[model samples]
Target chain A: MQYAERILDAIDMETFILARDEGEAKGFMGRFLADLGFTDHDIVFLEQVGPGVRVRARAYIHRPGGSYGWLAEGDDNGG
Target chain B: MVAEKKKILLVPLDPVHDMGLKLIRKALDDKGHSTVLLPPGMEPYEVVERILDEVEIDFVLVSRTLGYRVGELLARFVDLVEVSGLRDRVTLVVGGMAVRPELAAEMGFDAGFGPGTTPGEVVAFIEDRPFAYGGRAEASEGGKRDLTHGFSYVYRKKEIQKRLAAIAGDIMGWAANKTSPGVERARLRFQALNKGEKYREEFLEEYLDYCDELVVLSYKRKQLPDQTRFLAQDELHFLKQYQNWEGRSKAARSGIRKPDVFIQYGTGCPLMDIMHIKVCEAWGADGLVHFDPSGGARTEGLLEGYLAHGEDGTLLTWENLRLIKNFLAPNTLWQVRAHRGLNTPETVVLAGELGADLTKINMAYASLGAGMDPARITIDGVEAIRWAAHYDLPFDVVTNEELSGVPAHKAFAGMLIIAHLALQLGGRPILQPLFCRSPEVMIYGQMRDNYIDYNAAKILALQQIIDAPLWPGAPIGFLTHTEDRVQSSLTTALHASLARSLGVEAISIASSDEAYAGGPIAAASRVDTLRATHEAFRFFGRAGIQPTPRAREWSKELIAGISKVLKDVANSGSFVQSLYRGLLGGPEDGAYPGRVGRDTLLRKEKGKDV
Candidate 1:
């Protein structure tokens, strides 16, 4: 069992970035996720409020038809 | 009751915030504990001096709102208490905004309470008893509901009812003399299940005659279709293992009534479907709809076995359905759709035999939108409804032709005809109108102002026509969702709330992946909408979304249009001919009569009963 295996499907990270518009918010989200070592990430939502942009980004930890790490036996780290 | 009265000291360290301490003191007093309250703006030394001067203090409760240097101040207070040798004599507790239990422990306090801590919890802590917060026990008592309960299924509009009766009578009359391959398979399948081995073999031999070549080959050669495989022993073992795993229980509904929520699950594999079903069930879904492969409907016969397919829809089979059914919660309502394709009747029979609570059937959508011959679907759909009635399963007449560019009026006409036919046969049929941004709405700009008016009109018009249980379904918010989880979930929740406001019986909701086509819907996405719907329900407790006056206007137009379509259908002489002529939905409306099972009707031999 691995730590990532505990994630049922995907991890969504939402935050408010002090960006000027939707494009800048998306750029900041990409950099933020990339800084956190997330390569396969997508911007799920982005809306510009008066002060900043609220963004939701998702990274798929596991998908159907793939080998689910949680299903594996004898993995002590799996929760 | 406490063994003895315990003296407690409540200290408000903040200059302006003493609400938390005051509430705790009141609860302590109610619990029959002797308590002393220290005034606000007391220095750390003054609190220590008060505790020292108090006679045999049992607990010292301190409250502070988080601010600049608040942590250091709390630390200094704890250090002063320790230095005064009073830390070991009393149970020191700290709580306020931004104060966590971990931080309290780090600051040398025995316990901490953060924001939203209730007085009951603090009292329980003082009395050293476990506190049950929230309504978990009460939430577990929300049992399964029969959405159709208490509805009389009466028609309010006598003219529309009369027209529907005429159309239904014509349909039943035409179908009485007709039988398609789908109908024959259903009959033989039922007989085969009830009789002995010899009879089953004989029935199957005759059954192969009506099957497609691919089906016949699969039966004879024991080979499955492409991208499909029978479930292995290990997979079955895994299923049993998953079912037996601990902590699986019914989800709490958080007290929302009207519009019981259902999730549609068809992940190509029964194992995956069962997993998804469990996830949805544990996340407050009241029911589930099984989606079979589209190709399975077009094929002449159904495959048999515990099979897994690596595709879009699960293969409809007795073993597969039973396998999935075994894992469902006792109260979870299950619906296996038999609406379209070649296996409508047989699917209904199988679903009934497997103990499904509900089934779906619609002649118009099956023929027009789902690519089944109109004549064939009419015969098969009639038989399916009968089987559904026989099994005491409530079937829903879904108007999915609205998805194929047909206007709501034409689709409603088709749905009402089937619903009336079901009523005629003594069957309980739920009316399922698509709560979507349908092609009709898109083209006509009916939803340009808002999504409420047209959808509200659909319900209003249906209520004017009949009083059957209305379940807006087949995944509401269809064609209005995107790959964005938040947007998709918000749209689904909004639709669900609207359905709730309209007092609909039930609603079928999509996951956050409703618009995502890249892969199977992720399990987490299912929870997204469930949580959102729960929030929406909470936000509008007994309140409602107000649709504009246009809703009433559109409702009148829809009713008139439905009446016109029914008149046309009734005057077409034969209901089957009316379908062929597109009176209910024409090719111009993007509803083409399907070609599969075309000319496959078997005429009854002379002097032989059908």
Candidate 2:
């Protein structure tokens, strides 16, 4: 019934961050995930391109080997 | 029961986007339905008036692709249909890239088809029948494909074949009367699983002697290894709920029958693995290969229970395998690797009893690449091959030892010997050559010009030696991927494209996180490679990827090299001694005989290992 429970696993957020380097991009992403109320998160990828950093951030709504509420009674199976 | 066709009206409600509607109209016409098409840019009022002018239009199909104010425009059109009092008479359907089923239903449309909507799906909707999405989403209809269905498994070149046969004979002769604790455990496991619950304790009493302390702790106290845990009662119930849930999945391939894309899943937890399997299956993965923890391989035995781990490899357990197996889409080919482990034969027994479609066993890779003693693994691997035959499980003899700097010819020599030994033991063996950017390539610059020719040469060379099914990988494109998801996925997709061109039957593909060693693979990373592979297959369906003339030269070199290695292995007094002396691969070649399970081979007495 909860929105987070709708996701079968984790959700990945990919975007471009205006940062000087990979470390700065990672710092911004950590804050971004924190500001978005995510705790179980990781910066899966970060690369410093010409002007900005291309990054893929992930929030683990459900870690593996744990209970998946998404598997519970539901109409929409989220990816 | 076939539904009777009726008159239909197709309206492309957007400018210059009538392609979907035109496709639907053609499909409807093919199904003997009457249809009138209004070109793109038709006003909603004009469409409504046209429907009204028609003497009994059973259906009105509208397509809208332009997204700006689309919801409001659709809502206004639905209100117009309602005001006309014709909503009850006509089944109003909406479809296009901008449409969602819920959004259309909320807008008062009868149904909606979104992007990637096929023509047959629209027909299924109009005919009021359930669309099974080629029976892939729900049931099997020609879906349980055999990867080795047509391969003849005959040697093409007689000289190489003669050498391979002699080498394999020497290896089998050496392995014939040899046994190990691993083999003993496999026999005990076979007895335990078959003989009823009453005999379990008795079986474990004998089986535990062979198991390491960590494994014993897991069974006796229900204790878990580091970073691993057993699923709680509530979590198990949730998995049970998943067992009854029916979901949809499209095939990853765009219609090419060979080269089924297989993904590896083992997030150290059966629950996590099930989730990954669900994701991979839904994304069109045709098969799943179970990856056990490397530590578990070095350990003497496997554990049981619905275990979850915080690491990369899933712990090999009968309970874990059965739990994951229960959730696999019936059509997805399941491969439980019995390769590179102390429990090789035992894993085969578990994989077989649990209805696995395939198993992987390569004694050479086990000894040289995975750090298992050549002598111990050879004894157990031979037993594992026999069990593979008994269980009707065709296994891939992977030449991943090349990753440790072994050349393709030497690795292929080992692979061919094992494959030949499997044939002699009545087991079907698939040749798994790596389409990798391996150590050999980095050292020799064989792949400097392109990743295609050397890979093509490997396949071409193997084809000359034997007619067995070729499946190019245990995660193709190894050592070529980087931590960058795009690069990782692209390399995987490109290698898969090459595999399709070379006519391979299956390939073990890595997730987009293949190069990332810092964490367990993310679900999104898996999707990246699967989607890329799907696109690649779609992009290059039967077009063929051409390798340069260098491929023929490399193929000839590889064949000659394999023949020389096979001759040396056959001439060696003892096959086990040859492995120790590095006849298959040597120290300079970045390969050394394994130390794990070294000097552990036990002699069999009266058909039982002592």
Chain A TM-score values for every predicted structure, listed in order = 0.82, 0.86
Off by over 4 Å in 2: A1-79, B134-139, B606-610
Candidate 2 lDDT tens digits, B185-225: 99999999999799999999999988899999988998877
B1-610: candidate 1 lDDT, tens digit per residue: 5446789999999897788888888998987899998889899999999988989999999999867899999999999999999888999999988676656887889998876577878888888876643323233366566777898988899999999889888888787777878888998899887785779669879999889988888788988888989889888886786574333232323445567788999999998888777667656687899998898888999888888888888999888999999998776789999998899999989988888999999988888789888888888999999999999889888988899888999999999999999999988999999998998888899999999999999999999888889999889888889999889999998998898899998899999999988998877688788868877776877789999999999999999999999999888878888878988888798888888888888764431333
Best by lDDT: 2
lDDT of 2: 0.85
Lowest summed lDDT window (length 10), candidate 1 chain B = B245-254
**TM-score, model 2 to reference:** 0.88
Q: How well is candidate 1 docked (DockQ)?
A: 0.03
Name the runs in model 1 displaced over 4 angstroms. A1-79, B1-142, B195-203, B244-253, B604-610
iRMS, all models: 15.2, 14.6
Docking band of candidate 1 = incorrect
